[model samples]
Target: MFRALAVAFAVVLIAGATTFLALRPIEQVHSSTPVAAAPLRATTTRPTSPPTTTAPPTTRTTTTTTTTVTANPVSVVENFYAAINERDFATAWALGGRNLGRSYTEFVAGFDGTVRDDLTVTSVTGQTVYVSLIAWQTDGTPRYYSGWYTVSNGEIQHGKLSG
Candidate 1:
């Protein structure tokens, strides 16, 4: 359990650093909206008089830019393990997506057993993730299971476990 927790923390640290480095440059931050160049002056012909100076046309420009912070998908998976290991059911349920929230609520509504386990995350690819865990049941039996968790919009959509 200690090892797993350490690894998880390291992964999160690395990911955070990577994101910071990737978004450090000003060009990268403002790449979405390019600045427009100043317009050229119109040429006029005045044979008898000196050239007339006119101030550039007053242009009012309004730009609307939307900024969205994409939630890290791996955090959800990590939170799931962390919350479950800590026996914080409400936190675990919130980590799940809408569907999982409903499903887990229905499944554990009348249950009273606690799950103490260590979770080993095998892989996380986009919205698909895998984890291997060892859980100790109240009856003193060791339960080993592997789970495949599907995530969408940064939340765990659903998860299936097999022993």
Candidate 2:
């Protein structure tokens, strides 16, 4: 179990480091420009003949609308750690969205079969979507982790966990 935990921690650290390194260059290339909206057109047509009994043709014009998307909840992100610390996999799973909830349950079951009390969340930011944490064993040995949480449509869609 100890070996498995060590390997998991190592993998998380490597993955996080790789993601940070990967995204840094992309961030540098980021650009902000407003896209131009399409123009709208209207047309009027004359009827072929003036008739005693006439029906007008229904004309339809379509317009495109743009909307800003909003994000989801902090407790959704917070609950992952909360559930882990409490060993409440069911609650953690329920806290997440369809896919993430299932993933969290699998992760919990795969990782040590239980979460220790030493897991602590140090800080959370950006809709509580980002978290920094320190998880330790009873002996005070530390495991460091950092991850981002994404929420959509009132549910936690995904998370990227690393150390």
TM-scores across all candidates?
0.51, 0.42
Model 1 sits at a Cα RMSD from the real structure of 22.7
Provide backbone clash counts, one per model: 0, 0
> Residues 1-163, candidate 1, lDDT per residue (tens digit)?
5555555556666767667765565443356678764443333332333224444579899999998865676777888778777777777777773455356666454234545777788998778888997777777677789988987776788888888
RMSD of each: 22.7, 27.4
Q: Weakest 10 consecutive residues, lDDT, candidate 2?
A: 42-51
Clashing pairs in 2: none
Residues 1-163, model 2: lDDT tens digits: 5555555556666767666665554323335975554453333333333334434579999999999765445656666667767777676666663455446545665446233533344456555466666666556566777777776665577776687
Decoy 2 TM-score against native:
0.42
